[model samples]
Target: MVERMKTYKAIKYTLFVCCYLFWVASAVLIAVGVYAKIAKEGDVVDSLTADPALLLISTGSLMFIITFFGCFGALRNGVPLLKLFLGILVAILLMQIAAAVLGFLFSDLVLERTEQLMAKGIARYREDLDLENLIDFVQKKFQCCGVHTYKDWSGNVYFKCSETNPSLEGCGVPFSCCIQWKNESVLNTMCGYETQTLEERIAKDSIHTTGCLDKIVRWGKRNLILVGGMTVGLLGLEIFMICLAAAQISRIRGKVKTVNSRRRAR
Candidate 1:
């Protein structure tokens, strides 16, 4: 019985820690949500200009941070406040999962739509258009859209843009093919093209953050899948902790009552 009580105590404290973690995850998710909200405000992510990689990265990072805490919520802590916090964390994690699913599923849809629009844009920009310049334009636009490789920044990769501007112009035109991060800049792959005119356009295409999500997306679905898988696992742990916490509370109450009754009888 003592052993059993010890186990229960262990589980109870575990729950508390888990709940605390979930509270943390909830806090991260909330922070990410706030950042994304600010970044994506107004026009939001539209069909024509959305950046899949950026979306995935920003959202995934948020999930990753929050889910870290979420996993702890699965322990056996017997605190109502912690439970409440766990619930919030779980809910936020769920929303993030939903967002990821939406981002993943609709990604191809947006891709198809945007590609079609690019084709149209290409067709429309003909006549006075520069075919050479168009290649430059396409390359630049794609690079700006978070659609390139990591080594591409090192100027070593065989990117689509490289074929067009084989000369020094294409080799060093970082802004010619990269996204601009607001209030944040990096020395490596980023192009600092701060456009006030693109404020609306920026609001439409990219997930808002002081960081870049492009790094993950250019490689395909792996990052998002990893993040989603992590979120699901963390969420499961949180649920377990919450349930355990509840059980511990009941047991603790029962033990308290028994001890008090015996003392009164004595």
Candidate 2:
């Protein structure tokens, strides 16, 4: 009986420690997100649809609430709280599986929606600093230009190729699209200037004329194994946590039953 009790205590504390660590992490995420929102309030409002800080805050808040239930339930051996936590975990797992299946079955639709979002982002490129930086980073990393092609920059007001466009950046892509030079110490922000006016064959030599979406798709395919492994690892960890909580609940109930029976006998 003492051995069984010891085992129960071990499981309980282990679960507590795991939940506690996640709770701390969630708190930190929330803090950083709040700080970002406050520091760049103007920028965040402008990019409301694509604000990274808002994403962080929402994700962190959900994690914080879930981990709180896990921690409190484990420490107090509260059956209801533990059951709630287990149910939430199961629901999340199901949602993830459903999303993955839907994404696979409707890949074309997914791509189309992604393209639309990317186009919107491009259109508002100059309106949001965060979005601008994000687009530039992706372009440089993938060595690609606009959504479908370099010419797609025409969607942006400042980059429109119309003769009436007065902006100096008119008909030009961002510097990120430029072909980086070897051993270059400084970036030539104007390297992409007026490149859109050139023929495709000629422009390819100076800047990346390929679409970013194609490059991203190819990159994903090449790293499929890594992505799949990470997904599987996360699912396995969640399953393990669910099992631990279930076992602890059973132990608590069994102990309660034993105590009640002994009291009735007396």
Candidate 3:
């Protein structure tokens, strides 16, 4: 009985520590969401542009609430809070499974929606400075431009590549479309000037002619193994914590039952 009590204490404290760490992680996620919100303060588009920050905020808040129960319940040996935490954790796991199945079933629709969102961002590229920077960053990182090809820039009013367009940016791509050069110290803001009007062969020498979607798809394919590993790792950890909480709850209830029976017999 003494050794069993020691084992329960060890499990309880271990749960406390894990819950504390998870809580901190959720707090950091919330901070990142707030930072993203501030970074894109003036732009409020609800599509892909704003979804990331909102997702972070919502997920972090939910995790905070759930982990609070786990942390306090473990520390105080409170069965009610522990049960609540376990119930919510199970619900979350089920929801994740459902989402995965739904995503697979609606794969084509998801792809179409993604393209539409990207197109919207491209079309409104000049409306928000933060969004422009984000698009530029993605283009530079992936070494690709526009949605499916550099030619997709034609969808943007400012880069329509038409002589009739009055915008100074017409017939040009953003500097991010330029081929990055090693040892270049300064950015040439006009590196992509008139690129849309140039012949494909000629443009190939100075700018990325491919589209971002293909590059992004390729990137995901390449990192599939890594992403899968991380997802499994996180899911396993969550399951482990849930089990630990359940075990502790069982131990506490058994002790309570023993105490009540002893009192009745006395």
Clash number for every model? 12, 0, 2
Q: State which candidate, 2 or 3, has the greater TM-score.
A: 2
Which of 1 and 3 is the better model by lDDT? 3
- Encode model 3's per-residue lDDT on 24-132: one tens digit a residue: 9999999987787778756555554435666678889988999999999999999999999999998888888797788789988877887887888888787666567
- Highest lDDT model number: 2
lDDT of 1 by residue, 72-95 (tens): 433433345445545665676578
TM match of model 1 to true structure? 0.38
Give me the runs in candidate 3 sitting further than 4 Å from their true place.
39-43, 46-51
* TM-scores for the candidates: 0.38, 0.91, 0.86
Off by over 4 Å in 1: 20-225, 260-266
Name the 10 consecutive residues with the lowest summed lDDT in model 1: 123-132
lDDT of 2 by residue, 193-253 (tens): 8888999999999999999999999999999999899999999989988988999999999
The lDDT per prediction is 0.47, 0.90, 0.87
Best by TM-score: 2
Assess the local accuracy of residue 21 in candidate 2 as a C-alpha lDDT between 0 and 100.
93
